[model samples]
Target: MDRYCRRAGALALAVTAATATGALAQDYVIGVAVANSGGLAPFSQPAYDGFKFCVDEMNASGGIAGKHPIRLEVRDTRSEISEAVKFAQEFVDIGVNFIVAPPDGDPTMAMGQITSPAQIPTMTFAGTAPILTSVGEYVFGSYPADNQQAAVLGAYAAELGYKTAFLLKSPDAAYTQFGPAYFGTVFEANGGQVVGEASFTMNQPDFSAIVTTIQALNPPPDVIMTSAWEPDFPAFIKALRGAGVTIPVMGADVLDTPTVRGLGEVVEGVVHTSGGYPDPGSAHAEFNARFEAATGKVADTNYVVNGCDILGMIDAAVQAAGTTDAAAVGQALAALPETEGIMSSYTFAGTDRMPMRSVVLARIEGGEKVIIRREMADPATMPAP
Candidate 1:
């Protein structure tokens, strides 16, 4: 009996040692839940590519603190809010400390409910300020807010002498509604008049009625400002051109896409604003190069840079926290003062999980987009516009 007991103890000790070795050999798994297979895939794919590139580069450099190689466990949310929430929970269940989500306001907003309760840190490529304001902790956004873009575009329109401007937007989408609301407020405050305003539904195949309504206003507005996603802008532009409404068209960040450019001459001379320019020299040149080389296409102005920044930010926080624990990473992310990234220099401020300042404006000219200006001052510091 004594000999048998000694042999059993030895076997148990060897098993325990093997288990410890296996645990030590395991790599840290990071979750990436994105809308990479839906309507937003065009935007999310580049973001995924960017995150993969950043992670690959980091792993090549011996990974975070040289302790473990980080592995990204990607899940497609299909642009659905429920799917996003489920993926967040799934990631948590799988013991992933970090997550990066897509560019939709609703899905990202839904992630807040999941990650906050579970105490998992989530960074969204979407820039819906209200999401951060409503959720408070457990969520950080890397993109500039739509309201900020609206304010800047409004101020620019005011400067450009577009006193009587027409506002067109999609009433159904929160992102679409918020932009024009903020733009109208700033435009009116800056001595510009929103002479006409109209709202349409998302995925609507035609905007001819909206265009006709705007044109029939007593005195036509000087500039037409668009704040819709999906079929609205393309339809509106095509309808407006068909109706011979040639006034300059302006819009928010949604206009800074290849889709707009693909409209060819219909969208020519349209002005838009973006958080970061898509040029090679803009902060993340290497990222852009790698993205183009890998995807066989130039990067567009979605959240790809923001996604890269999200990964880089996580890496930075991991470096700062010195651990892969979710709580430690959350603290590090919330406490991050500033970090230079591909999108923009991010700094947390005003209880929001993103930088309060740091935005840029871009315009499409000669069938190509160009950065009109960068590093625009925060709204609080700027002259009352």
Candidate 2:
């Protein structure tokens, strides 16, 4: 059975049955608008599942602060911004206390335009663009900003004694556009050189010209870096390797998808920043075990923990504020102390809505992901968004 199909029925009962009987008085009515089918589904589905998993655990533990049971209403946005907006407006009309938004920025932003003015705190599980916070105070992002991921990867590459780097940037989104430049800035600051730069549109059919350009460099760069995701990334890597280019490649969290894992040996030694890795004994590993027990499926990506972390923070904020008033809850969320989340230790204390969290760097070897290290990016090196 589809896990979401089963959970959807239970969610309806939890939302309506308890209130109809007056059995749960202090309930947190939360709205979820995540894509279950569409281009964003690969990332959003697991994240939505994680949110539901956390909701199940919290309600089983007697809910937030042991008294307030959560009532969830979920809608599939199908990766469309219009659907996201419509559902967000419905959530506002029904006066939901909080919202879990879609995975990508455009939908999240559209939802925020509705929810923020209505004073509903909205959190996006995978929208990492730093500017998402500009939507309003009610909006928050669970993933690290693009610059943060770039800083971590670039700093790690320099630490590995890579003296020269080449960047392959994409014009598809802010994530691709800014991430490569930010990486270059940090790499140069660390005494490394950016030997060359190139740009490609998302899903570009050919990389032969780019590969030739890299090969023709007077002294080849020690490593290649990029922030492209999905089909584009895999295609680029395959073309580079197929053309006999052997330079190591480093990237941001965009590489943390199931598609990349399918590359197997092609991705060996590829380094990238991630939300978190489920190494044994880690909090993420523990959560994954529970997730499997609860859903009968293993998480395919670290994005699962991104949703869990967002909900956990919401729980903490609701408890701390002692009420679900949007202003109070929003303030509490922004003021949360560093929390040990399934993803990592995160806090929103000093900035907009972006979480300051440790970045996990991982390498693929033998068709498995191995953690290289976890570190906080240098705030001084974080490029301006």
Candidate 3:
């Protein structure tokens, strides 16, 4: 009986040791809440692919600090504001250490409340300036601010000698409203006149009414600027051409997509402002390559770049913190300098959680969105008035 008791005790101890070893090798889960499986799914999928590629590479490389393997817990927010809030709550409940969001200002704004309280550092890929800086130190944005794009668009329009410009946008989307509104304001402030301003609904397939309004503006504006989505651009351009309005059409970063390239001649003269260039040889070349391989498509837009940079930023923060602790990660992210990323080098400026002031202007030339100018907001080139 004494010998049997000793063997049983030894077996129990070995089981506990094996269980503890398995627990020690478990990975740290990072939650990604984007507009996957929704209207923006096409764009978000590429972003998610970029993020996954990053996480896969990290895990293959022995992960952060060589202690924990990284795992992603992705949630599809459906591009709805309420769904985003629910996903954020779910992420909090799951005790996820990191969160990534899509390029929707409203959704990110809703998520800020949950993440801020949980003290989890978030990286948003949206261009919404208000929501981005509003989240305080808890959130950082990989995409350039909406207002920065406005400044770049204004400068590009002025350079093209567009003395009279007409602004058209979708009233429902923050991107549609804020982008054109701010661009118009900056353009007008820079000695250009906004001759006509118009709004449309996102679901509106026909832009005949808006095009008619634009065309009826006595001496038609030299340029017609819009903040429409990629899918809507081709149709809107066709409507404009059908309405016999042949002025140069310009837009925001929404025009920088593979779908836009399919528009061919319709998008030829259009110029748009973006933070990233589509060329694979650009800053995020390897990232783009990985994303393309995973998705069976090229990373030819800002969404993928945003995802790559967000993950890259998180990787840097984890390395800096030396652990996956949320608060420590936030502090490490805040302390990050201008590190070169797959998109651009982001430097935290003062108390602002937004990226450093760098913007690039891209124009559709010969059926491709080509980089025209790269500008950094410095003492000489201050943030737009």
Each prediction's TM-score against the native? 0.88, 0.89, 0.88
Which pairs clash in model 1?
A: none
- C-alpha lDDT of candidate 2 relative to the true structure: 0.85
Model 1 has a clash total of 0
- TM-score for candidate 3, residues paired by index: 0.88
Candidate 2 vs candidate 3, lDDT winner = 2
Model 1 agreement with the true structure over 163-276: per-residue lDDT tens digits: 898888676666777777787888888898888788888788778888889878878888988777655788889999989989888887777778787888888788887777
Backbone clashes per model, in order?
0, 0, 0
lDDT of 3 by residue, 359-379 (tens): 778777787767787876442
Query: What range of 10 consecutive residues in model 2 has the weakest lDDT sum?
Result: 18-27
Measured with C-alpha atoms, the lDDT of residue 125 in candidate 1 is: 63
* lDDT (Cα, 0-100) at 6 in candidate 2: 84
Model 3 alpha-carbon miss at residue 142, Å: 1.1
Report, for every candidate in turn, its global Cα lDDT versus the true structure: 0.74, 0.85, 0.76
Question: How should the candidates be ordered by TM-score, best one leading?
Answer: 2, 3, 1
Tens digit of lDDT per residue, candidate 2, span 189-295? 88999999999987788888998999999899999999888788898888899888889999888787767877966788898898887878988888988999889
* Each candidate: RMSD: 3.6, 8.0, 3.3
Q: Model 3, residue 186: what's the lDDT?
A: 76
